[model samples]
Target: MQPHNRRTFLALGLLTLTAACTGSHRHDPDGGDQRPDPDQPVRLRAVAATDTLLAAYDALLAAPGAQTALLQPLRAETARHRAALTAGTPSTPSTPPPTTTSPTTPPTPTTPAALAVLERQTAQSRLADLGAAGPPLARLLASVAAANALHAAALGAPAEPPAPAATPTPTGTTPGTSAPALQKALSAEHAAVYGYGVVGAHLPEDQQRTDARTAYAAHQSQRDAWQRLLTTLGATPTPAAGGYRLPFPVTDPAGAVKLAAHLETGLTTVYADLVADLPAPHRPAAATALRDCALRAHRWGAPDTPFPGIPDPTDPSPTPTTPTTPTT
Candidate 1:
């Protein structure tokens, strides 16, 4: 064969061999080739974050005086997020166990399968911390906690850890009721609704101002809903304060924009916690509200906080900090 022809034939042979080897590689049905072992660790880490957050929220709920009127709604909201994370989407079981156990100690299922379970558990724990809560509050907490216990059992986490212990009954209060956390959430909502006023005034007579007004109205509706819930529970909602303290003075249009941005951002974080603390059934509604707030905050140009799933705007480096107690 000619020298050029010999080289061409050898190159064709090498290409054929390469294609055969690549085709023989194992792949997921989605068509992406991946090592099964590495995939397992990634799944474990993602699932572990959900479980860890649930555990942390449970610990926080058990803390003394943690349950308050203002905090209950937040707790409920957080539970919903946890549920969405742990059981929002169903996933195929990568490693099926021989047998299922009690609900509180099941094997950890696949990431997508367990998202809702995690969201509900996290929210329930938060609700439990909100003391002097009512049937709606307790029902939400108990239901989510029960579901999470079932989830734990399904995931095969050791049942020996003991399910979250019952919170102490609030003294000089109606049976099975807490209100402080709810009160706090309502207070924050009031401030948020009021802050929008400052924000709206500063926006130029354009679409931005109109959008801000709509968000302000939504906050008003949320605030009113909390008030109704409180009233139904035989508790009076705290009146909106005459003056809300801004993080900074609103001196200019830019300053007003900044204040509005901060308001939505802070609310998003707080709502994230709320979504993390509620039961599965109530999660969808709470998540919708939380997401709306997040989108609005993003539109309003709020600064992002440090959390997974949020876009990272800084250098890729970890920072060390003192260990802090959990906030329900």
Candidate 2:
């Protein structure tokens, strides 16, 4: 095995052992204390190992000149490991609960529900990781991790406990129309594409210009996809404006970098909105895409905006403006 692969396996093995030593403790969604139970199956250790292995494979794929031949085999191995771990604890009806010694102590619950929850949580975490991580590898990892998370959730074993609200169906401008979140997202994409053009124009050198151009193309591709989706749903996409106002002057390379960063931030927020508004089956894709943007933005040195889930401070103003646009 390659040096990286060998190291990956060794690391995963250590992780598994560490988890085993800790015993099974379900993380309370409410941020309460863990309910530790020795009887709880240590399946999480194996599941975690699978995650590490998959992550390692992702890193390898991210490297330059990675072989397709290696990728397929690595993916296959990951799948096999996942299957083995999943099979060990098939979902079954919850058995009659045994009396627990304490609230902090988990009852000797049956295998199925716990396992299902673990799988779902794993998937969700992976998707979140994908969003937080950087680059070509980030996208690939996010895609796979999101898929796994969905699968785990479907198995009725969610890593995180379900929220009180039932999963909301996608809603939009009109009742039973495209989701509102999606419409907002399309607008955001339009803004990002426009912003990139403005920012790219001011880049000082050939390399900076080329990088901006490449990023612009990616945004365009995303914009086109959103547009197509909107058209299919009978909604008109938000048209790109003639001139998007920038938050600051793009008079120098630093200014160009700042503009690029802002564009990335916009893209991330838009993608996140899409993820939340999409129906369950479609959500994973949106989430993965949004994460990709966020990771990229981070790499580009964008200041982390407050989590978009929170109400924007400027929302109440009649003229809610973004950063000041640089006048030519």
Look at candidate 1 and tell me the lDDT of residue 224. Answer: 79
Score every model by TM-score: 0.43, 0.45
Q: Which candidate is the best by lDDT?
A: 2
Which 10-residue window in model 2 sums to the lowest lDDT? 11-20
For candidate 2, write residues 260-289 as lDDT tens digits: 776665555445444434543455556655
Q: Runs in model 2 with CA error above 4 Å?
A: 1-125, 128-177, 303-328
What TM-score does candidate 2 reach?
A: 0.45
Question: Per-residue CA lDDT of candidate 1, range 151-177, in tens?
Answer: 333333333222221122223443323
> What is the model-wide C-alpha lDDT for candidate 2?
0.46
**lDDT, candidate 2, at 158:** 27
Q: Counting only residues 3 or more apart in sequence or on different chains, how many pairs clash (N, Cα, C under 3 Å) in candidate 1?
A: 77
Q: For residue 187, give model 2's deviation from the true position in Å.
A: 1.3
RMSD of 2: 18.1
Q: Model-by-model lDDT, in order?
A: 0.44, 0.46
